[model samples]
Target chain A: MNKGLLIVLSGPSGVGKGTVCSVLRKKMPDLVYSVSATTRSPRQGEIDGVNYFFKTREQFQEMMACDALLEHAEYVGNCYGTPRDFVERTLAGGQDVILEIEVQGALKVKEKFPEGVFIFLVPPSLDELKQRITGRGTETQDTINHRMTVAEEEMNLLSHYDYAVVNDEIEAACHRIESIITAEHCKASKYLAELGELPAAIEKA
Target chain B: MNKGLLIVLSGPSGVGKGTVCSVLRKKMPDLVYSVSATTRSPRQGEIDGVNYFFKTREQFQEMMACDALLEHAEYVGNCYGTPRDFVERTLAGGQDVILEIEVQGALKVKEKFPEGVFIFLVPPSLDELKQRITGRGTETQDTINHRMTVAEEEMNLLSHYDYAVVNDEIEAACHRIESIITAEHCKASKYLAELGELPAAIEKA
Candidate 1:
């Protein structure tokens, strides 16, 4: 059986990445969403294993030391990482695995697995992204402005990724992501080595 | 607006390409089957432009002289070729064009338009291909054997093509082809370029 592909999705805050991922998960049931292992305590209603693999700081540090994590980073003094074993097991079962990580973690994952498909999602316009951040009403104006500036820096790295989807509309963005997954399977490099062996086998037989 | 993609199909005889192309055309109306131009006289009920752009030997030679033909070859003293003008016009109109041509013509078209997706349709197995060819009972045993030999040669050239679809089941083959076309549109080369100008445009306004 063909192993499932690894797909990494990264985008700036307020780009509707979560909404797109939700719709995509509903459409593709077999998809495996990689839940991060975090040292931070779970908030209300957050399941331990289902929401995250809530680990102790020592446990997280040990995993990082042993190279057990595909990617890990400390954010605001809390450690978050993707467990490599779970991802490998899911991919071995011929089911696609989606990693929703930040730009830094995404790049780290790609360095380890060069074949992983990296997708960068973008808002339709910078103004629109600002409007979205402000509309949330949770962040102060200063915080929103800071995120908008950070988003511009992230957009500069868009050219480094494999493909970019404009998260202007939820359905359309999901469709583009689905199409990207389908298309990556059609790559010649994936089958060329197998095809090369066929001719030799035929000749030997 | 983004122009439609062009796809070229090539395979040895008895590979079930005709059935695959027929099903694909019905499934994708946006896919336009390119009609070839020929120096051979039209058979009864064959319409001009629809069936073929019937041309005299001199006219065909003139097209070759002016580089009007994308690809051309002579078989049994009759000439057949694809006109570049008609294909470009169709693609410019936002319709995906498919050329069901032989391997030689397919290669030529690839050289002229490197972006054109080339698909090679193969049988499930060499033995299966021979069985289908012999089952037809329209050709002599010697002819069937010769075709099987030719099929092997074509398989050797499979690496030169972009994708290979095994025609074990008609519907399955069509689905693979459709998936390939859908996927090609999501190529990093194509999608990333669109993102390039968007950021600059958004920042300017």
Candidate 2:
């Protein structure tokens, strides 16, 4: 069996990565959602292994020192990271793994797995992104302003990704990502190395 | 408006390039079919400048001498070439162009337009390709053997293409091409160069 694809979906903050990921996983049940390890305490109803591999700061630091994480970052006084072993095992089993993460982690993953498909999701517009952040009605003006600056910086990171998908609507974004997946499968860059011969691919076709 | 995409579809002889192209065009009305200039005589019901830009041997040679053709190849004592000017004009107008040609000519086009999206259409298998050629009922045994050799050589040229699509069934093949088009538009490689800013693309989204 072919080793499964590693799809990293990430974008700027407040760009709806989480929402898109949940809907996408529902539509594509075969794509395994990678669980991360975090030092933050789990919220109510969150399972230990299902939602995250919750750990103490010392344990998280140990995992990092052991190079057990694919990518990690500190956020709001807590460290979050993707466990590298799980992703490798799932892919080795010919099941695709999707990591819904932030820009920094996604870029870090790229450094390790250059072959992984990196998709940078963007909000429809900067103004709209501001509106979404502002519409939340919880963030102060300073927070919103700070987010806009971060969003611009994240968008500039678009050059590092393989594809940029605008999260304008849920279904449309999902469909475009689905198409990107299909296109990547058909990419000659990978096909030539994978099949090694036309007869085999033709026969399988 | 963004410039249109130039899609080159090529494969070994009798792999259904013409058949698949016709079906794909029907499904995608916006894709412009590129007309080739050929030294071959017009067959019954074939119109000059439509089916092909019928050209005399002298005129075809003159066009080649002037480097007016994107790519040209001779077969069965006749020359066929794509008119570069027409394709250029169409794409400059933001209309996508589709070129259905043999492998050699497609490779030549790549020399001038390295950015062109090259798709290699393959039959399901070597046996199936052979069956399709034989099913045509027009080749001598020597010709069949010769074509098989050429097909193998052509498949080897697949390393030059961006995609390898199997012509298993016409509809499935067309749908795959359609997905490729959608996927190409969303490609980050082109997006970074085309849009230049996330705000622009996001707003459009």
Candidate 3:
């Protein structure tokens, strides 16, 4: 059996990343969504190590200091980071791990774990993205405009990704992601070790 | 629409490349199987262009001289070559073209068209490969040994391929190939142009 892939799926705000991921999970139930350790207090109904790995600032900092986190970021007064141990164990157990993060965090993860399959999810068009953002009805017009600007910046970073999936339709996007994972498992890099053992296997045969 | 991929599907003898390709073509009716120009006389029921672009030795040599053939080789007494024009036109029309060729010809195609996706098809095991070859019942023991030797040589060239599909089950192998084609379309190289147009399209929106 092949080792599971470390898939980093990132997109700009309001590209339906969460919805797409939900659908993807239904298709690939074995996929492990990485839970990040955060210093912020967990909201109601959020389970420990499920929604987020709730941690104190001291614990988060200790994790960072010990290089236990794959990537960490400080946002507004809280430190949030993906724990390396969970990801490694999941991958070792032959279960694919998905890290859903923003572009900045995705790039940070890329720097630390370059072999992870980095996927950038995009909307069919900017108009659709703006519409989706507006449909949320939680943000002010000014905030929406700021997000659009940020999205523009994020689009520039698409070159850094290995694959770009367009969220035109939920099912189509999910299918593309699933296919990407299946295809990635067939990549030469993933099979190199097995290939190295081929001569011995053949000799015995 | 994205331009179609030039996919080179290669395997050692008796790996079921043809059966796999036929099933794949049934699933992907739009896929164009490349027609090679050959100097050998066509067997009964072989159409001129459908089976092969049957050409005289002189005509095949002319194509080779004019760089019209992507890859070509002389085997036994006859010459065989992939018609570059047919492949280019098919891809330009946004239809994927599959070139089922031997390893040497595949390597030649790779040199000529580096962007082409090279896929190596393999059996589940070398014993299975030998069993399939002997199961054909057409080869002498010496010829079977020679073929096994060639298969070993071909396996060594696995490093040159982009992906490897194990032919344990035909549907599973075909599905993997289909997934590979889908995932490759999502690659950054293929989407860079769309990503470039993103800003302009967003501004217009």
**iRMS, all models:** 2.8, 3.3, 1.4
Any idea how many clashes model 3 has?
0
Query: Superposing all C-alpha atoms, what RMSD in Å does each candidate have to the true structure?
Result: 3.3, 3.1, 2.6
* DockQ for the candidates, in order: 0.42, 0.54, 0.73
Chain A: TM-score in each candidate? 0.85, 0.86, 0.86
Poorest lDDT segment (10 consecutive residues) of candidate 3 chain B: B193-202
For candidate 2, the TM-score of chain A alone versus the native chain A is: 0.86
Against the native chain B, each candidate's TM-score is: 0.83, 0.90, 0.87
Runs in model 1 with CA error above 4 Å? Answer: A39-46, A55-59, A74-79, A200-205, B38-48, B51-59, B74-79, B135-140, B195-198
Docking class of 1: acceptable
The lDDT of each candidate is 0.81, 0.87, 0.86
Cα lDDT tens digits, model 2, B1-205, are: 7888999999999899988998999999999999889888886777997778999999999999998999999864678899999899999998899999889889999998998999999787788999999988877888898898888878889999999898999998898888888888888887777776656766564
Better of 2 and 3 by DockQ: 3
Steric clash pairs (candidate 1): none
- Comparison by TM-score, 1 against 3, better one: 3
Could you tell me the fnat of model 2? 0.76
Instruction: List the candidate 3 regions with Cα displacement exceeding 4 Å.
Output: A39-48, A54-59, A75-79, B39-48, B54-59, B75-78, B195-198
Better of 1 and 2 by TM-score: 2
Model 1 Cα displacement at B17 (Å)? 2.7
Residues A1-205, candidate 1, lDDT per residue (tens digit)? 6778999988777787767887898988878999889998886667898768999999999999999998997754578899999999998888899988777788889889888999988777788888888987767778887878777777777767888787888988888888777666656565655455868745643
